[model samples]
Target chain A: MLELSRRRFLIGVGLSGLAVASPRLMAAGSSAGEQTFHSRPIPSTGESVPAIGMGTWITFNVGGDQYLIDERTRVLETFLERNGTVIDCSPMYGSAADVIGAGLDKLGAHDRIFAATKIWTSDGSETREQAATSERRWGIDRFDLLQVHNLLAWQEHLVTLKEMKAEGRVRYLGITTSHGRRHRELARIMETEPLDFVQLTYNVLDREAEERLLPLARERGIAVIVNRPFQGGSLFRRFQSEPLPSWAPEAGVGNWAEFFLKFIISHPAVTCAIPATTRVEHMQENMGAMYGQLPDTSQRRMMADYVRQL
Target chain B: MSGATWLSYSLQDFVMFGPEVFLRLFARINQDLWPWLLLWPLAGLVLPWFGRQAAELPRRLAMALAGLAWIGCGYLFLVRYYGPVNWPATRFGWAFVVQGLFLLILKGRALPGPMAWPVAVSWWLAVLLLPWLSVLEMPDLWAIALFGLAPGVTVAATVLLFAGQPSPLRWLLLMLPLVWSLFSAATYWALGTFWLMGFPVATLVLLVVALRFNPSPAQNPGSQSVHRGPGRQSP
Candidate 1:
């Protein structure tokens, strides 16, 4: 009986070990067979988070289609399997929150997920309603991060977010903007407001955020979640035809996803970059960015110049 | 800014409003009313053919169903379902109601005739079954178009009904459905729902038929002519 029990324990340990090893193996297989994920500290908490996170904009908006839901389930599975935590979504993104909820439910990913979504409506009452709706849709009691989407009624929503944070309904409060619309106002809010994180577009071509938002967030010790690292998949079209600089592999950039993502996360100010994707293969390539030596300042310059020339 | 560089967008992007916005509309409508709704489009196709005793009876019946199609879609789909996502749906719902009411009021004479049996049968088949077309060989009935929610059967029914009518007002009856067809097609295109391509294709066919079978209101006042519509080929 003792020998039998010992055998059962060994089997259990072996299976658990395989489960953990599989993800690292998958990461290594993709990243030229090495597994070491680099992380950056969230300045507010001084706690490190994996530099690469997931985004759910156009990618996870499959609505009620079971096939689409199943497809996205794999995406979230791949993300969490690779140690991805932050998942950014919005109420404006149609049925993405519901699908993400379903995916997390199916994978039993509730414990591991670092839930992040936005309130993207007008007025403070609507903000409260939308935030509750988002929580229900995501099947979570609370969120890790909640942002005022595009600063729409930002002041109104900020008050609610701060209260929620204070009440422990949410861990962090921040704001987001896109399409490069209202930077001056966002800058002022970040300076005057006590935000824990800020998400904004930053990539190879659209460096507009780098000018003001990134600098301000860093100065204020507000963790920056860089969005649109590939500029809404625009980088693929813009640079697909061009060959990667020969020296990219030296910095552990295996594909263009890494090339773009590495650039954003490598920035001293960028706490994390949430690159959105649907395909597991694409997610694997994205997680590859978290591994290896990120491009240094000169290499970042070389990468940008190559892109411009192309 | 599609106005500035419309050509710059790919055919896919030009059509897409995003899969979530596009598909969620179908899901909500489907969820609110599912198998019961399928019969609406089927009725739009099946009901009009029964009143063939009078030359104008079939035409009146067709017009009534067409109106119901518009009104049903306007209330259930445009106003109730789509109003939240698209602000313009409220106004479009009113327009559909007006169009439907016009059909109810203006059942005066035979427009021309119902589409030939073959064309009519094809409309029925496409409406009932097209959404079932799938690469995975499984159907999501939620995506299917019922009569009032969208135009799948109803548009075809109206086109067939007006194939026999030759009044100037047929253009008024035809106008909104055509625009809606184009809009639905663009949404389908964006969602990568290839089977719904028939919506836009049917719109194109109707355009050619409208130009050929009917006259510009300027070309002939009263514009009553002997020419038949696209469905004239059936007989």
Candidate 2:
């Protein structure tokens, strides 16, 4: 009986080890293979962004304690190693910009970052001050993209951004809104304002952007950044039990999150889709969506129908 | 100072002539749901904190309040901004139902053990169905039932399965706020704005504090190690 129990224990340990190691092994195998970049042209400049961008909204705000600080540093290192260029954060995100600054400093990756951030305050003076503070925090001389976040103080900030752009303090000036709330205003802004980019929500679950914002962006030659491809956590929750649809393979989506994200980026207007992830594994999966064929118009419709059916 | 004055004046004027401002804003816009969307994370951050003091009761009240707030906000926005469009009443109702189930499952006496599949299943079904129906336009009830509800329920179920006797899933489920922090970040990032970024950072700090200040394992019945099946025990 003792011997039998000992054998059982050994077998259990072996099985558990295998279960844990299998994923790591698969990951290693995948990484060992060749790496590639999937490029999309910026509508305004016709320059290409590497499709995948790192969002630092929650993940970058790692401060207060030592352990969290350490974890955040690791996350930053992982992000840089993954070839992610676009680092999106804002002053409204509670030290996110500051933390990311520190992370970039630690990783020595500041120059590598495609720094994208927003001015959230409504007052023009505050907007200018915040924009300056963001620059100081990130330790950058010029911002790649300075966006008016959620249309909050958009007009006030737009004038400031235009001035900054003219003075060479910012490379691009744009406005962003998520949640399909201000597409019409966004459209007007797109029409009148000489915006280089427009960021908004676009996911399989929330495709309201498709009806107008996307076409407007395309027509106006504004680069599009898709936010909320997962609908916060709603998409993840929805796909938890459901197997990846068979059609996912055709679109090069290895997981459900990618399936949703790839669908958004597949749009011609989308220069990049920023999907924030805390876990390294999730970031890797999201990056995979950047690779492979994005659905063409017909494929996008088909994909949309498939997701709707699910 | 003059800039601040002008800003306040502009906002006050905008508020005073709300109808005109709405018309002007919506003239070219297809729909304006931005203000309504801001309430989601605002409710998420505020409700949990307000309910923190009352423990389970406060949580339940907050959930109900949030549900009501969402419905009311949606209605007000539709009426004020969208102008009596064909809004989906059933979807809004389902959102409240899901929120109710979520609160029930979360606030119940001593977190239900893994055996509480009913609560998990129901909560999952509601969230999946609410969003799928309202947001995604998915029509299949079974797909909503299976996919939407399954992941979170499974996470809870896994926690419950590992939880030892006398310790319900609640203690382990406290890790949920950490997970929620992740989701909140993802949501904000996906939404492409920096709002709600503070909540996750605050939650993370709170979690760290709770971990530090909370009583040691000897004092808590739920601290016992969970046993796996057939001679297996967690390390």
Q: Write down the lDDT of every candidate, Cα atoms only.
A: 0.70, 0.55
The residue-by-residue lDDT of candidate 1 on B1-235, one tens digit each, is 2353445455553321355555456666777786677667666657546433234455567667677777887877777656544445657778888887877776534344434455455456555554443211224646556655674445644565554445456566667777777766766676666766766676556445544543333543332432433222223
Position A17, candidate 2: lDDT: 50
Off by over 4 Å in 1: A1-34, B1-53, B64-175, B185-198, B204-208, B211-235
DockQ of 2: 0.02
How accurately is candidate 1 docked according to DockQ?
0.13
Model 2 lDDT per residue over B18-124, tens place: 12222222221213343343444344334434333323444345445434443442333323322221123224334424443554444323221122223223333
Interface RMSD of each: 5.6, 19.0
| Candidate 2 Cα errors over 4 Å, as ranges | A1-36, B1-235
Candidate 2, overall lDDT? 0.55
- Across all candidates, what is each one's fraction of true contacts kept? 0.03, 0.00
Lowest lDDT sum, 10 consecutive residues, model 2 chain B, at B226-235
Best by DockQ: 1
Q: Which ten residues in a row have the lowest lDDT in candidate 1 chain A?
A: A1-10
